[model samples]
Target: MTRPAHIAHLADPDDDPFGPEASDRYFNRELSWLAFNRRVLEEACNPAHPLLERLRFLSISGSNLDEFFMVRVAGLKGQQLKEVDRRSADGLTAGQQLGAITEEADALMASQQAVWGDLRNALDEARLHVLRRDEVDAEATEWLETHFREQIFPILTPQALDPAHPFPFIPNKGLSVIFDLVRRSDKEPVRELVMLPVSAARFVRIPGEPARYVTIESILKRFAPLLFPGYEIGGAAAFRVLRDSDMEIDEEAEDLVRYFANAIKRRRRGRVIRLELETGMPEALAAVLKSELGKTDAIITESGNLLGIGDLDTIVDENRPDLKFPPYVPRFPERIREFGGDCFAAIRAKDIIVHHPYESFDVVLEYLKQAAIDPDVIAIKQTLYRAGKQPAVINALIAAAEAGKSVTAVVELRARFDEEQNIYWASALERAGVQVVYGFLEWKTHAKVSMVVRREGGKFRTYCHFGTGNYHPVTARIYTDLSFFTADARIGRDAAQLFNYVTGYVEPVDIAKVSLSPRDLRSDLLALIDTEIANVRAGLPGGVWAKMNSLVDPAIIDKLYEASGAGVEVELIIRGICCLRPGVPGMSENIRVKSVIGRFLEHSRIFAFGNGAALPNDGARVFISSADWMPRNFDRRVEYMLPIENPTVHDQVLDQVMVANLIDTEQSWELEPDGRYVRDEPGDKPFNLHRYFMINPSLSGRGAAIGASDAVPTLSLRRRR
Candidate 1:
């Protein structure tokens, strides 16, 4: 994907700060991800959030770190162990990146503990106490004793760590306690390892008014004598293990389902990537754990009293609405209701976009449900990636197939940790007479698309629902994403071609109205950047505004740098990992980057360009996508980027959605060239994008029901000098 010849001379190798030879131009992707997690940790410290909400953020940070170690660190360790000398985009070798990641991750883990400590105290003040072992009063102890004997002791199994019995296998993310015990009979020392049952709740709540709780580990330690009656308890501490959970697909495997089933089992026993011990673990016990489970180059960290901090989310679920974010109910699209809930009628009139978490995701499900029961509907094609445990979406598909409609589901089994669930979904879908196709062995099908064909008037009209997020109802309530419902023939044809490309291995050729990856998506994006540069050179207005989860693709970043050098004003709202260094003097001085992390996750992907006019205008180009600006998204995934052509939908996405993100100050963080993110200061008029969206109706979703008196507020960008 080379730049156009007309603008090839725009970059001066000798003077370009982001030139190919500049090693320092990009930040390390791993370190940048750690930095993003730090931003999440910072939210735990933000006093503006409700107390339990802050605790929720802290728990999220802990969970994020666990996955990072299980996948990212494990991959690096694999490369290092295999003696592969591959380097990162920023020019660091595998070993070097691992060293840096360890440093950053350790500090991040420490910050998470610190935040947890603060939240724990805050919880106590709010009348929700997480009582320590010593704090358990006589009344509580009597009650807990019965609870332990009845509920927990029955599941207890203690294994001695001796030559006779080898160390027990700890599952990935397993939390256990190593006990130092001396036999009462002979004063003989014995070490026992007690693995915590995954079925048990991490926190056991006492039935009382103040809502008191205690950690299961604490209860076990307090009642160690009950489990080991013949021994006196000595030094004991808790520990947890994080194993390498990443799966490797064998290219030569005969069956994908069987391969993944075995792979999931293997992942449970994969090499331990991290060992976290309590801060006060005895040296003898720590050494035993290290020698046994830390055989590989596993990072060992000494954590606080809490081992699995991610389990704090269980406590956050307590019925304490007073200490959490205010309850929010998403609004169903007014457009869909305008047709008396007829999704086909709304789309047949014109295109519409549903903003999730603000507008309902149930609308997406309703569209499929309607199609399932519609006698005129003849066919349905959907892509499944990260559908949550619920079967709402799955049930709709099965209904459509059972209704005698042609239904095909392209289920991706390589969706990271969601592999097992995807497999189960695929099997269930196939059993329901749905033609389930697992897309390419190498490239994952990550596109979020659903198409339905219905006979209308005299011809078959195809209606497509393209989303920037998954069809999962749970995530839809908290993730900010876009769902575009369209009956436009061009997009409908493109959607059909996309399905064919995935199901039949028929490559899409000269597709109209959309760009698909592993083909020309990257080159197409570059061409768009080139157009912005050319517009500047031709003395017309030039600008670019894009938002995504991450920005790590070197080719795309370099093109943005060239565009910035050519006087195209570039603005990006990347929520997570971003390796590009914005505002470098000679490299991207005209570019600015910010991240928005707030009440809801920013998961939507949007891109807009000034087509010979200033942005937020009718002449601008807008598109929503299922791909982020990352290497995995571009080179190894089946993704799509579709343009927003309908004027009302275009105005809604660009004017309301994109503009609110740009103008948001409460949850924004400005990125510096030095890789530090400074929080955006919300001065006098502190505008919150989330709050704005929650209150106002989206333009396209408002439909004709919105009268002049029900005027939705307008937003405009601050013109650049």
Candidate 2:
């Protein structure tokens, strides 16, 4: 790929705050995240996608924004309240960034509403009607009335607005109803707020053909007289509040667990960051809400359609397989089956690399199951970060522990939004006799590594499983992550050191292959880059290829810019929140950046660099890590970056995954120095990388012993070498 003249424009200081003339060109972290959300929203508008899937995407986008507001926007608001006007690297003050964010978010909300409108119509044509109050039939209305009185009415507590009643406490992210209350005898009106019952369904499906849906707000409107029988009906609108839900802990406190408990309580009562009101609300009522909530003008928003459309997740349960993509059940690799489901045998036969969803996560599950039943297995060591509903991984650990095997599981209780799930798993593991250890009080242990110590042939051998993703099997269908299984003693020993570092705080000084973070991963990466830079200066062929979820650490970007200036080729596949400004002349002329968005989320952090040779051995380093190239990953969390050494695993990652992503034109978006992402124009020969993976088997699979058939020549002779 050749550099374009637009690179000069990108490098101009005026184009960005950190242009060539200025100090640095840094993109706002919050803005880059918003752009990622926008890309997610774009999926809803993609007509080429399935209608229900598009709706699901919209709901997911909405939920994502809700969290972003609760965390990111709320944090910014806190900074502003503290009179902290620290300017971001993008040269915008906290208040200025907040103002810009409000404008951008408002526009995004409007776009969401517009897209929802189109999706609703499309869904209606497919025989699904999200009905208004007036659209419900008389028979369904009677059924709903009975259902409301029996189910909803008993649980609802409606407080009359008077001297006796005070404003009800609104929980964070709680949806409610606000109205103008007027007396029956006298037509004088006063403000009233009726919090919509949280326990009730957001969408009530009307009993009829094609399943008509009515929102809870609409139902409340239809039954307004029931709540206020004597008072004259007044204007009512639905609203929702998003409060600061991010937990804060007292690091200086004596007990970390107690402090977290206190933090959780405080999080529930966090200050309101956003107020979303129904469309056509009485202006006076809206103003009163803003004043009561202590919100400024910017916090108030008029939601023209549904206030909390994330409830559409209920609609997505419609069992309409025809309207959705064909559900794909993961296939257990033939390599494992050929070994009669012996995970150890399959892994030992040849280095096996399995792609998730396309290739079964069963291999991971089977690894645990095999260990659980194996009489020779002595101990199992694992890390639990975010285990989904019914985590088979946890069950396997429990089984192993119950079977009188030494099982140690490091469970992170501080996984945000997953604290409850983690807590549940921790308790379950404890009950099952598993030695569950909550990580260090200060740092989160985010590394994903599992080990099994087994006695074979009168000797103990450690089987290590290192993955770039979580142990959540549910997410494996969507998130693209990498997993490596090996019996290498050196790698297993390094993993043991990592486990001890978290559970026992014994940091290893020298690691044979693996590089650990919050300690050595950064220096190791920098050293690698330095080696590449030297090669470039030496007039040797050198290049860098890295794939990550996000990149925001300025120091790393600066290092990359220096490497770019050294004539080293740098290609980045950053899925979200990239602060680096690529293709800037004089700054990053040799750098190119692209992101892949497709049916599956583009995850899996892979880092590779050319060894100034055809194959990278000790000279060329390739790593798969669980950490994103961010400040938190480097300084705040415990992480690991393990090198891919085995020949088959190396070739699969380098020649297959890395090469395929670099050449993909479809589903790719290029980020400009101006912080705007431009989708790659379709090539003359359109190539869908995701489709290719779905249809074709990976190189690792084809190269496997079982996949080798009579039609193809055997590679046994080559392997003998």
Tens digits of per-residue lDDT for model 1, 378-401:
999999998989999999999999
Q: Write the per-residue lDDT of candidate 2 for residues 1-721, one digit (tens) a residue.
A: 2212222222324544533433245667887888888888888877767888899888888898899889989888888888895766656566766876787788888888988899988988999989865678888899889877887778767665656877777898788877677877887776667777777888988775887888887787788788777676678888889889887655677865556666777888888999998888878777767777755333778877688767788898887887787786666776777888788988777766777766777789999988998999999999988888777999899999989999999988788888777877888999999998877777788998899999989998889998888899989888878888888889888988988998888978668888888998888888889988998788777778899999988788889999999988888999889878787889887888888887888888999877665444334668899899998899878899988877767867776676667666677888886667887776665556666566666444664323211112211101110
TM-scores of all models? 0.95, 0.92
Candidate closest to the true structure, highest TM-score: 1
lDDT of each: 0.88, 0.79
CA deviation > 4 Å runs, candidate 1? 1-22, 703-721
lDDT of 2 at 438: 79
